[model samples]
Target: MNYISAEQLTKSYGVKFLFKDISFNINEGDKIALVAKNGSGKSTLLKIILGREIADGGEVIVNKDIQVVLFDQEISFDGEDSIEEFMMKLDSAPINALRNYHQSLYSTDTKFIEEALAEMEIYKAWDLENEMKQILSQLKINDLSVKMGMLSGGQIKRVALAKLLTETRAEHRHTLLIMDEPTNHLDVEMVEWLENYLSKEKITLLLVTHDRYFLDSVCDIIWELEDQKLYVHNGSYATYLENKMIREENLSATIDKANNLYRKELEWMRRQPKARTTKSKSRIEAFYETEKVAKTNTSKESLELNFEMKRLGKKILELRDISKKYGNTIILDDFSYQFQRGEKVGIIGKNGVGKSTLLNIIQGLENYDKGEIETGETIRFGYFSQKGLQYKEDERVIDFIREISDNFPLANGKTISASQFLRLFLFDDQTQYSLISKLSGGEKRRLHLMYVLYQNPNFLIFDEPTNDLDLPTLTILENFLAQFQGTVAIVSHDRYFMDRIVSHVLAFEGNGKVKDFTGNFSEYRQYKSQQEKAGISETEKIAEEKPQTQKSKKRLSYKEQRELEQIDKRLPEKEAQRQIVMEQLNNETDYEKITLLSEKLEALTSEIEMMEIRWLELQAVLED
Candidate 1:
């Protein structure tokens, strides 16, 4: 059943066209990822379909039986309300008894609390509050007393997510969720949790996100917005890439034919007399139309970086015995590493494990508690932070570019005008005079990036560079970075971007522990998993090697011990099965088969974990 169907939809921003005559249907149980470049009306389409924005032509028809939840770009909270109050306000269909019960937990109002629990049991919402708390804990939101308005952007996003994913809804009908950049402020763990929830939940989702790993894992169908039209591709993100390649290939061949036809028509027109005959005039007009289309239909040009990069010396930045602490919390302890010349490093950690702090220390803006730092003779640095550029509201785009530099002096001694550089980043003649405030979030990020990279620094530092960027822009940025001659140290949670860009990683485990991983995120995750299994297996073998005590009376009988040993054997088999299922998940193209296998894998994983606990219990008993 189709949850939402958009037919012949058209939209425009004054003289700038967004998409026209676009048609698509979103079915129930469909996890569709809408991907497009910045300012390409991906969000506009969602708004129109959700009835928040009006379309220029045609309409979006949503099924009357379904409910829609939108996790919009901007999250709002009411005045002077606690976290629970704000959550309950958004969850409008709240159970009165449950609400009172939650409030009662922090108070001594015992007269009514017990009665509310009884009422909750009547509705079988006995576990509802506990479930909500568990979700909050997973999201790292522990302080319930904090006001909604006082929370940071990331925290507010998390609270909003908790409301959608964990809060109770009215019974009966299913809900269709539409989100815009839902993974914007999320760390990798949070994104993984959301991915599992969305993929396993019995809800339909339409979301726009730049996290390629999240998109590939959660979405089964991809809707690509390009050249003012929607192209729908089935299967995973990998499949989408395959389809896009095929489409571009076919389009390239068609354009070649058009170009051939265009050249022949040009010759005929040049040779023909300047006659006002209908046949001659008609052919001339047709020739112009074909030429216009052939030009418009051609693929976008790649970004070229002619960086005037500073020369790097052999002694690159190095740190020995670096330590930092904030009050009672230790962020980094006894950390030491020597950054090599032309090294591409990825910095990864949870929300507050000093990723940005480390960058600040490197730039000499923040002092470490204990550290000996050394830098090369020549290492000019440019840092692109997630704290987005602060532009004057009235400042024009070209003026801002000119502020950075009037013209770029390439490393090879070539000069390009500031306006020409703007054109390279997709700002055109008309947009040169446009106010900074007019740019989309992603466009603003791109402009900020231009400001950072055009400075000709040999060392580049990027903090959460993927935040508001669309995937296409990210691809361009990746291409630009690939050609860059500088050393880069990036702090980003984007697994795909990290894997593509970096050669090594600084993995921040919690509690002032850091692991130096010599590979990308995916490779490191796999390596860590295998190491953990091996460690556990080795520990078990050493226990078996130990001699039995002389006075030992078996606390656990021989049969129970045998059962536990058998469990160890079965655990590895189940783990192997899990790996096989995961490999199938990565390779499988059929949706139904993928769904069934995913469910089976989830169940099998849960059972294995439970059995491992049982095995531990039996081991403890025997040892005692």
Candidate 2:
């Protein structure tokens, strides 16, 4: 059954239509992703559905007994209220009323009190309390129970989410939960916990997020709001993308065929050599009619983003033992790193871990204490600050781009046309005239990206570039970054974006120590896990094992001795062979030669492995 339905829904702010003629039906057990550029009315549409905002023109039909919960980005907590009190506030009126009635009856009649108590027990208030405790514990928010009202924004969001989840579970309600940018303030572990919970729960969800991993893991459908319309694509975000491309290709072919027919009609009309009669004029009109239909069928072309940076010397940028201090707080300490030419590095850390500060220092926008920084002669850096161009509220979009373009030389040695350049970034026609203040967050981000790309810098630094972008635009940005030839450094909390664009990860844990991983975010996580396992203290392991070091030594004696001798003899040969293979692998472009060398290396490795196995067997025999 359709739980909620919207038909002919239209909304606008002044003369601009946020979205119009949107119609879709959401059923039970549906997990839908509401995706659009930031400020493209995603929040407004949610409000309209909740009846908090009146739609300009639409019919919203909701099923009876349907309950909706919305998690907005701006969270407000009552300072004087306790966490328990807040949870109670989220409870349905009937639940509260029933509890009150039961308490009153408990003083009146013995039988009534017994029955009321039974009802309360069946309602599972005890289980709700326990579940709340468990959730708070998992989120590490239990410690903030007493200070919930005074907690940071991120902490408050977690508290709100906990209350929301508790209320829905307590009521045993089939509810539709709307979340807007819920992952914005969540840590990776918290996000994983949320995803796991949502995946197991039985609730209809409509979420707006830039977190691609969350979308792929949680949503079964994607409702893409673009160009004043809603495009419903079934399946995960990845599947939606694949299907969208197929649809675009089909549309392109149909448009091409239509254009050919229209051209043929025009050619025939020109060959008439006389003023067109009514029939000929009608045929020309028919051609235009066909063209109109074709136009409607055509998909909008994506912006052609060609990012070419001038070649820089081998040493693009280097930071030697960099450190930064703010007041008494140390943001970065002894962080040494280097970015080589063509290296795509991603910077990740918890909020306020100096990811942005490091980027600023690299870009020469900020000064750092106790560090040596170097840049290549041909290296040019472009910085996309977190605020982007959104901070300039009064500026027009075209004027902003025009001002930035003044520093760059055009193709003909003339000033670059602001309108033309902005159009390449998907600000076409009337959109060029839109005020920066009026533009959506995603639009402002795109404008900023265009500005950075126009610089033709060899080194690009983006701070949370995917924050408010739509899914399509995010894909476009991902493609551009993947194809970019220059060194790129990005500070993003979006794991999906990081994984797609970066080949290396620079994680800034607190205390100024940075860890560099050779692969993307996912790979970095795996590497971190391995390091954690390897760091397990011997004392802890001993506590779980037989006490004496003598027993351990005796158990390992023979194998340890044999392996020690084997390693002593084999190490030099293995090292020599490994070095030779590495050198050849570096220069050998021929796949067949590389494959042969890899096989030979594998055989050498197996011989060392066999020696270790034999040594282990000898150790076991000696112990016996």
Candidate 3:
């Protein structure tokens, strides 16, 4: 069944056309990804389809029978409302019933609770409510009572995501889910989980994201919006790329032929006398058409970075047993690493796990409690943050860029004006003159990146720099960083970006622990999976390999030996309990009981895995 069909859609901003006379169809179970350069109307197209925005010309028809859920890039809410209250505001029958039922559990009003309970039964929202709780839990939204204003942008985005997913799953069979930049604020783990969830579920989806890895894994169809047109590819991202290259190459060859014919036609026209003949007039018209095709650009242009980096001394930056804490939470503990002259390290972990804290400490922006930091005398630092570019709404893009420098110096000692530099980053003359508030999210991100690179710092620190960037800009940035001759450190959730730029990975496990691997993100993930299969964590394996200070290796204590024996004895019992709960879950017809049994089974399985890992740790200690 076709959920949506768009015909001859035309949209433009100001005098610039975003897409013109574009037609596309979204059918049932079509996992489509919309990709384009920044400011190319990807989000605008989605808005038009959803009726949030009007198209200049053309029509969009959506099946009224199917439920539609949108996870927008921008989230808005009443600041005073709590998370639960915010969820209740959604005009979804099942969701409103579920939210009211949940809110009633914290109330002392018996009559109100009874009414809410009756409504819940009418909607059969018990299973949905349970699923909602699980979704919130996995997204780390623990405090449903927190005021909307108290949450950070990332937190708000997560809540919006939870709400969208819960609604989608509630109407999973008949839902058409549309999301824009859904992975922007998500961590690597969360992105991976979401990728798996979307790929495994039978939900129709259309989303715009710069996360190529997620797109490759979750989407079976790719839509490329370029030059006021839409090109559809019926395959994964990799397949789309391959086909796109072939298309570009064929276009290039065709253009070359056109150019050759245009030269001949031009010579013939020039050789003809100033006499007006019907045959010559017809030939002249044909020549003009040939010239048009000859002048057509074969592919999108990408800028190459050849900027000279500042000299780095041998010492570089180093942290000696650095430790930091905020109240009871330890952000970093006894962390020590020396930066080499030219090294790129990617930092990844769960949200609020000290990845940003580490970057701040390295730059001396944040102080550490128990360690010393050293930096080379000649080093210069450039920091790009997740907080993004802060500028007055009325400030022009060119003015903001000019604040850095009127002239940007290249590697060959040549200087280009600030306007030229902005153009290199794809900001046209009109766009550069426009106010900052007029730019798209991706456009703003590109400007921010241009600001960072203009400084020409020898040491670069980027925190979630890929949040609102489009794929083409990401590719350019990745290529620039990969060729950079400076020391680099990044904290990002973009797996494809990390894989392309970084040479090492730092896995920040919570509680102030970090595991370093000398490989790219993909390699690190593979190594981590292997370690987990061997009953060891990445941190444990790294710790075991560290140089020993004492002549004798440490042995398991008496208490540890007893604990190991206890784990061995408890494992079988927990496994048996898990089996019993699983069987009950399969046989239970009661929705409430099934939810309870599933939770019990999950907990039991986690306990058993913990015991087994403990057994392995204990055995390793004894062997040492």
Each prediction's total of clashing residue pairs, residues at least 3 apart in sequence or on different chains, is 0, 2, 0
- Give the C-alpha miss distance for residue 75 in model 1, angstroms: 1.5
lDDT of each: 0.80, 0.74, 0.84
TM-score of each: 0.82, 0.74, 0.83
Which parts of model 2 are misplaced by more than 4 Å? 10-21, 37-41, 54-58, 78-88, 93-123, 137-142, 145-152, 267-285, 294-315, 323-333, 360-371, 375-380, 388-393, 406-416, 509-512, 530-624
Error of 2 at 84 (Å): 6.0
RMSD of each: 11.1, 9.4, 11.1
- Highest TM-score: which candidate? 3
Clashing pairs in 3: none
The predicted structure with the larger TM-score, 2 or 3, is 3
Q: Which candidate comes out best when scored by lDDT? A: 3
Candidate 3 runs further than 4 Å off: 99-122, 271-275, 392-395, 415-417, 537-547, 551-624
Over 108-216, each residue of candidate 1 has an lDDT whose tens digit, in order, gives 7677788766767775555666777777888889998899888888899998888776542433466788888888777888878878877787778898999988998
lDDT score of residue 385 within candidate 2? 72
- Candidate order by lDDT, highest to lowest? 3, 1, 2
**lDDT tens digits, residues 332-397, model 2?**
887767788778998887766778888888878889989799888888887777665644767777
